[model samples]
Target: MNMALLPSMVAIPLGIAFFTYLLARKSSILADILGNLATFSILVISILLIKTRGVYVIGGWNPPIGINWVLDGLSNLVLVVVALISFAATIFSTRYMEQYTARYKYYSLFLLMVGGMNGVILTGDLFNLFVFLEVASVASYALVAFGCNHEELEASFKYLVLSSIGSTLVLFGVAFVYGATGYLNMASIGGIMATGNQNTILTVAAVLFIVGFCIKAALVPFHPWLPDAHPSAPAPISAMLSGVLIKALGVYALFRILFNVIGLNQLYGTLLIVLGLLSMTVGVFLAVGQWDFKRLLAYHSISQMGYVILGVGLGGYILATGGSSSVAALAILGGIFHLANHAVFKSLLFLSSGSIEYSTGTRQLKEMGGLISIMPVTRTTCSIASLSIAGVPPFNGFWSKLLIVIAAIQAGFHAVAGITILVSFITLISFLKVLRYAFLGELPEKLKNIKESPALMGVAQAILALFCIGMGLLLLPGPREFLLEPAVNALIQGVEYARIVLSGS
Candidate 1:
C-alpha cells in the first residue's frame, strides 16, 4: 500500500462501523469479525507509518491550503498506542460482552471512538482536530451510557455537560487562532507565530485551549466527572479511556499547540507546573479514600498524568528560559516515557478490575477478600500493575519516576523532586490498601467459587503485564534510540516542526 493510504486506516474503521450498525440487528457475528479485522488492519498500517515519516495531504493538496494529515514521531507513537490498545480491547470485548445485548451497536461505537482518536492524532489542522475530537468524545459519552443504569446515565450526563463546555471553549480557541493568524493549519500558524510577537488575543486563545484540554484530561480542578464516568463504564471502555483517550486529546494536543505552535514561554510553563502539582497532591489524596476499585484507579489517572505534565512543562520552562538543553531533554524524555508506560499499566489495572467484576459482580474493594486463592491470575497481574504504578524497582514506573525526579533535582527544583518522591510513596500506600482489601485477605465464603476471566481477557491482561515488566528496557541504549528518542526530538524541536513538515517531499 502507498504510505499516503494511511488515511484509509481511519476511513475503513469508520465505514465498517456504519455498515455494522446497519447489519447489527440481523447478524452480530459479522459485526464482531469486521470490527476485529478493521482494528487489526489499522494497527498494521500504523506500524508501516512508523517506518516512514511525512505529511499526507487530503485530496492531493498541500498543507496550509488544504486539509493535511501529518505523520511524524509524535503522531506515529500515539497511533501505535491507539491501535494496539483498541485491538486488545476489541479481542477482550468479543467474549466479555456476550452478556450484554446489542453487541453490534457496541462494536460500532467502539470503532467510531477508535476512528476519532486516530483522526485527532493525525490531523495537522486545528479545526479538523476539534471535529475529530468531538467524534471521539460523542462516542465515548454514549459508550459510558451503554449500560443505561441510573448511575451510568447520571455519570454520562455529567460527563456530557462538562465535556460540552470544554469542546465549546476549544472551538472558541480555534476561532481566535484563525482570526489572529488567518490560518488553520498547525504548521502554517506555527510559522507565523514564530516570526511575530505575542498578543492578548493569542494569550486568550492559549488560556482557552488550556482550560478545554485540562477538562478533557481530567486534571485536579476539572476532574469531577472522571471518577463517576470511568468507574461506571464497562471495563474495556474504562481501560481505553484511562489508557489513551485523555493522553491523545489532552496532553498530546496541548503540547503540540503550546510547544510547537504558539511557542512556550515562562508564563505557560509555570502554569503547567502549578496545575501538575495540584493534580498530583489532590488526586492521590482523594484516591486513598475511595473504596470503589475503578473509582480509585480513575483518581490515580489524574495523579499520574500530573507527573507527565510536570515533566513536560519543566522542559518547556528550560527551553523557553534558554537553560541547559540536556536538562530540558531529560525532563521531556521522562514525561514521554512515563506517558507510554502509564498507558500499559493503567489499562492492565482496569482490565484486572473488569476481570474481578466479571467473576464477582461487584467493584467495592472492602466487600471482597482472599481473591488470590480463587483467582490467582487476576491477583498476580493486578499485583504486578500495582507495583508498576507505585514505582517499585525494576518495573516501568520506577524508571520514569526516577528520571523525572533526577531531572527535577538537576534543574534546581529540589522541592519538586521531594514532592514527586512523596507522591510515589503515597501511591504505594494506596495500592497496598487495595491489595489488602480486595486481593490478599481471607477468602470470604460468598466469593469462594470465583474463577479467572475468560481466555481473551487473561491474554489481554497478560500482554499488558509483560509490557509493564519489559518497559524498563526502553530506557536502555538501543530501544531508547528506536522509540523514545524520536518522540523527545519532536517536542524539543518545537516550532522547527513547521520546517520539517514544510520541507518534507
Candidate 2:
C-alpha cells in the first residue's frame, strides 16, 4: 500500500492538461506527444498499483477531518480501465483527429475528463465525487459538440440539459445525505448508518442517487440522449464515453454508494434488476432496426451495460435476501468482469467504426461495402470485436455473459437468465447486420481508392482487439484471485469497507 503514489494518479493528468493547452496550442504534434505521455504514464502507474492499496490523506490531515484518496481494489481496477482506454484513445486520436482543429484544446479537455474520472475513483468522500463527476460530464459535453456542426451542437445541448438535470438530482441527494448523517466522508456516513440507524432522509437520498446515476448510465427510459450524443461525437471521444465514462461515473458510483455507503437492500436490488431488464430489451430492439453504423453501436452500449447491471443487481438481491455468499460473489464477479470486458471490445468497435468512416467518409451502412479486401487491419480487428460483442465462443464477452447466466440460474433467477440470453441473441443479430452490410458486400465504387487507417490508429485498435481476445484469461484461478476477487470482496464487504477506510489500512 503505497499511499503517496495514489495522488499521482489524479495529479499527473490534471497538471498536464493545462500544460498541453498552453504550451502546445500551436503544435498539434506537441499536443499529441503530451496527451499520449500523460495517459501512458498513468497506465503504467495503474498496473503497478494493482497489488497496492492504501489511503492518501491530503495536506497531512486524517480521515473524516481531511479530504483523502483511497486506492482499494475497486478504485484500482477502474483507474486501470480509465488509463488504458484514455491511452488508446489518445493514440487513436493522433491520426483520426487530423480532420479537427484546435488539437491542443481537444487534448486538454480529454485529459481533464481523464483527471476527473480518476478523482471520482480515488476520492474518499461524497462531495468530491460529485465535483469530479461534473468535471468529467462538462468536458464530455464539450467534446461531443467539438465538431461545432448543427448535429453535434444539437446533440451536445440535449446531453447537457439531461445530464444537468441528473447532476442536480445528485446534488440534492448529497444534501439530503449530509443533513441526515452530518458527514461527507463516505466511510463516516457508512459507519453511522451501519449501526441500524437508517432514516427517511437517507432513504430519499438513496432514491435520488439511484435515479440520478440511472440517467447518467443511460438505462432505458433515461437513455434518450445517448443515441444522439454518441453518434455525433468524434470516434475517440465516442469510444471513451461508451467504453468507460458511463461505467465510471454512473454504474460504478451508483453501486459503490449503494452497496458500500447507504447499504444495499432488497428493494433497491430489485429496482436495479428491473432497470437492467428494460435497458437490455429496449436498447437491443431499437439497435436492431438502425442502419447507421455509430448509432447502432450507441444503442448497443446501453444494452451491453444492462448486462453488467443485471449481474451485480442479482448479486445484491441475493445478499440482501440472506442468500449464499459464494453465489453472491459469483454474481458480482460476472458483473465486474463484464465491466472490464465491455470497455475493451466496445472501445475497439468504435475505433474500428472510426477507421471505416475516416477512409469511406460515411457512417451509413448502405454507403459501405467490401472493406475486408482493402482495410485488412480494420476488417480483422472489427471482425474480432464484432464476434466478441456478440458473445461468440472463445472471445471475452461469452465468458462474462455465461457467468451471468449461470449465476442467475444458481440464484433461482430463471426468468432473468432467459432475458439475458434473448438480449444477447438480439445483440448478435444486430452486429451481424453491421458485418454483412459494412464489410462483406461488394465494395462501393466510391471506396475503391480508400486505404487502411494510419499506423497509430491500427495500433490502438489492435491493442484493444487483443484484449478482447485475451481478457477471458482473467477468469483463470491466479488472475481471478488477484484482480477480480478483490473487487467482489470490496463490494460484498459492505459496511466493512468503512471499517477498513477508517482504520487507514
Candidate 3:
C-alpha cells in the first residue's frame, strides 16, 4: 500500500459516518457492518504505517507552506491504540446497545468520534488539530446525553458548556500564535519562533494553551464534567471517552505543542508538575469515597493521567536544565508508556462495569455482592484490570509506575518520587474496597439469577486482560527497540522536530 494513503484512514470513516447517519432509520444492520468495517480497516492501515515513517503533504503541498500529515513513531502508536479500542468497543456495543433504541444513530456518532481522534493524532497543522478536537468533543457531548434521562441530560449539558469554553480558549491561543508568527502550519511557526527572542504574545499564547488543555484533560480544578459525563453515557461510549479521548485530544496535543512547537522551558515544566500533583491527589481522594461503580473509575482516570503528565513534565524540566539525557529519556518513556497502559486498563475497567450493569441492571457498587459466583468471566477480567491499575507486579501498570519513580529519583526530585509511591499504595487501597464491595462478600438473594454478559463482551474483556499481561514484555530489550524507543526519541528530540519537518518540505 502507498504510504500516502494514510490520510484516507481518517477521511473514509468520517465520510461513512455521515452516510450511516443518513441511512440510520432505514436499516440498522447496514450501520453496524459499516461501523465495524471502517474501524477494522483503519487498524490494518495503522499497523502498516508503523513500518513506513515519513510525512504526507495534504493537497500535494509540503510542510512550512502547506498542510501535511506526519506519520512517525508517536503518531503511529496513538493511531494503533485508537483503532484497537474502537474495534473492541464496536463489538461490545453491537450486543450491549440493543437494550436501547436507535442503534444506527449510535453507530454513526461512534464512527465520527473515531475519525476525529484519528485526525487529531495525524494532523501536522496546529489549527487543524483544534478543528478535529472540536469535532470529537461535540460528538461526545451528544453521546453523553443519548439516554435523555434527568442525570444524563444534566451531565451532557455541563460537559458541553465547559468544553465550549475550553475550545474557545484554544482558538484564541491559535489566533495569537498565527498573528505573532504569521503562519498556521506547526513546523513553520516553530521555525520562526526558534529564530526570534521571546515576547509577550508567545508567552500569553503558551499560557492559553496550557489552561485550555488542562480543562480538556480534566486536571483537578476542571474535572467536574468528567465524572458526570463518563457515567451518564452508554457504557461503550464511556469506554471511548475515558480510554483514549482525553489522552489524544488533551495530553497528546499539549505535549506536541509545548515540546515540539514552542520548545520546553522551566516555566511550562513547573506548571505541568504542579497541575499533575494536584490532579493525582484530589482525584484519588474523591475516588475512594464513591459508591457508584463507573464514577469511581472515572475519578481514577484523572489520577492516572496525573502520573503521565508528571513524568513528562519532569522529563521536560531535566532537559531544560541541561541534565543527563538518559534521565530525560526515562521520564518521557515512562509518561508515554503510562498513557498507553492507562488506555488499556481503563477501557477494560469500563467494559467490566458495563457487563455488570447489563446483567444486574445497576451500577451501584454497594448494591452488588458476590458477583464472581454468577458472572465468572466478568469476575476474572475485572480482577485482572483492578490488579493492573493498582500497580501490582507482572502487570503493565507496574512497569510504567516503576519507571516514573526511578526517573523522578534520578532527576533529584526525591519528594516527587516519594509522593508517586504513596499514591500507588492509595490506588491499591481503593481497588481493594471495590473488590470487597462489588465482587466478593455474600451474593445478594435478588441478584443470584444474574448471569454473565454476552459472548462478545467476554471476548472483548478477555482480549484486554491478555494485553495487560503481554504489554509487560514491552520492557524487554527487543520490543523496546521497536515500540518504546521511537516514541521516547520523538519527545526527546523536542524543538528539533520543527527542523526535521521543515527540512522535509
Taken over the whole model, the C-alpha lDDT of each candidate is 0.89, 0.92, 0.88
- Please identify model 1 stretches exceeding 4 Å from their true place: none
By TM-score, who's the top model here? 2
Query: Distance (Å) between predicted and true CA of 302, model 1?
Result: 0.7
* Candidate 3 residue-wise lDDT, 132-233, digit = tens: 999899999989999889999999999999888888988999999988888888887778767754868988999899888888888888889999999999
Error of 1 at 176 (Å): 0.5
Put down candidate 1 lDDT per residue, 15-34, tens digits, no spaces: 98998898767777787898
Off by over 4 Å in 3: none
**True-vs-predicted CA distance for residue 106, candidate 3, Å:** 0.8
> Considering lDDT, where higher is better, how would the candidates rank from best to worst?
2, 1, 3
lDDT of 2 by residue, 44-154 (tens): 999989988788888887768788788888888888898999999999999999999999999999999999999998898899999999999999999999999999999
Q: What residue pairs clash in candidate 2, if any at all?
A: none
Model 2 is weakest, by summed lDDT over 10 consecutive residues, at 1-10
